[model samples]
Target: MRSKARTQILFFLAASAGVTMFGMYHVLEALGYIAPPRPFGDSIGTVAFGVDIALGVLALALLPSAIHHDPMEVEYGYVGPPSALVACLVILSVWMVSVLAAPAGAIVLISLSARLSLYWTVPAVCASLMSALVYQLTHSPADPNISWSTVLGSVVLTLVLIAMGSVRGLVLRRQAERAKQAKQARQAQSPQQTQSAG
Candidate 1:
């Protein structure tokens, strides 16, 4: 598959995972096994969450267009570092607000043509902290004797899944890059061959 399609597929899968995690956390919380997480700031905080959701939705909408159009095709202010910064901030804000809604959005931004220079390692670290914070802040164990094994296991499992996804995504990206280079090479050769034949 083309890189664009692969990216879309990965985003969809990641989004599903995020939503599932959010749902599971809520269910577990209701069952008294986990603590209840709160919204942003109470009443106004909900607006921030709304913004987060909106940004995610926007990213989803933009990914398809990114496939066909060069993200840098625009004039001044339309592409570059500023845009990348905005994209990252929007994604990070989404994660800050709702854990389950950030994946697809983040992936969308990453796949864009903005050419963000930020390394993925930093965000990976942030993700680790985000998950841990959510778990700790929302703990609601009825028994004080409960061990942290379950939490640790869940975290480890999540990391493993993320690693697998990242590897898969990287493979897809490399294939796409190679394909692009091959096509360019062929185009370059075709004109020379035509001239020589003429």
Candidate 2:
């Protein structure tokens, strides 16, 4: 159990680091700190970008599995509103710092809400709203008009990613349930067989 916990913590840390690096890279690029690829290096740049995106997606997808509680440890009940509220606050705080931190905030919320409950939707919605709010606040008035499409896209993407995490949680929950039922059936059969033999 100790070894398993250590492995989970390590996996969570690694995924978090990868996600942070991926988010920061794009933030820097958006701020013009990282130049676009030159004509000669375009293909190379595209490949690198694709790899980064793949890593980011993989990290997000694995996050629920990495942090999921053991079936025996999980309490079978709905998580209350307070838990959802705290998750929303955490995501809001992260987004307040920078809209570019949306991915990081999503990760935090997803990890928090990835369980067999409806609580995931609360933080998911909050994160999406915060993304749009931060974008509006950060956009300069003098800059070209705010692109509503960009805001909408961000909101949609945030919801989609978090929904994916929720789905993962649901799948894990179902598998655990099936395993528990099978174990119970085996135990029942064993007792009956012993009685018949005696």
Q: Compare the candidates by lDDT and give the number of the best one.
A: 2
Q: Tens digit of lDDT per residue, candidate 2, span 1-198?
A: 115776466556655665676677767866789754333255655664674565345444544343444434344674434543454454444442342333545655555556545555665566567656654554332344566777787677666766776776677668767988999999999999999999
lDDT of 1 at 66: 35
TM-score of model number 1: 0.45
Q: Which digits, one per residue and each the tens of the lDDT, describe model 1 over residues 1-198?
A: 235666567767766876676567556756879644343234543453354456446644443443233444233233333444444444543453455655654454344322322354345435544544553444322333433565476456445545554565466557656877898999999999999999
Error of 1 at 146 (Å): 9.2
Query: Candidate 2: lDDT over CA atoms?
Result: 0.55
Clashing pairs in 1: 35-138, 35-140
What's the TM-score of each model vs. the native? 0.45, 0.58
Query: Which 10 consecutive residues of model 2 have the lowest summed lDDT?
Result: 93-102
Off by over 4 Å in 2: 1-76, 80-88, 92-103, 139-145
Kindly give the stretch of ten consecutive residues in candidate 1 with the minimal lDDT sum.
109-118
Please count the clashing residue pairs in each candidate, in the order shown: 2, 0
Tally clashing residue pairs in candidate 1. Answer: 2
Error of 1 at 3 (Å): 9.5
Best by the TM-score measure: 2
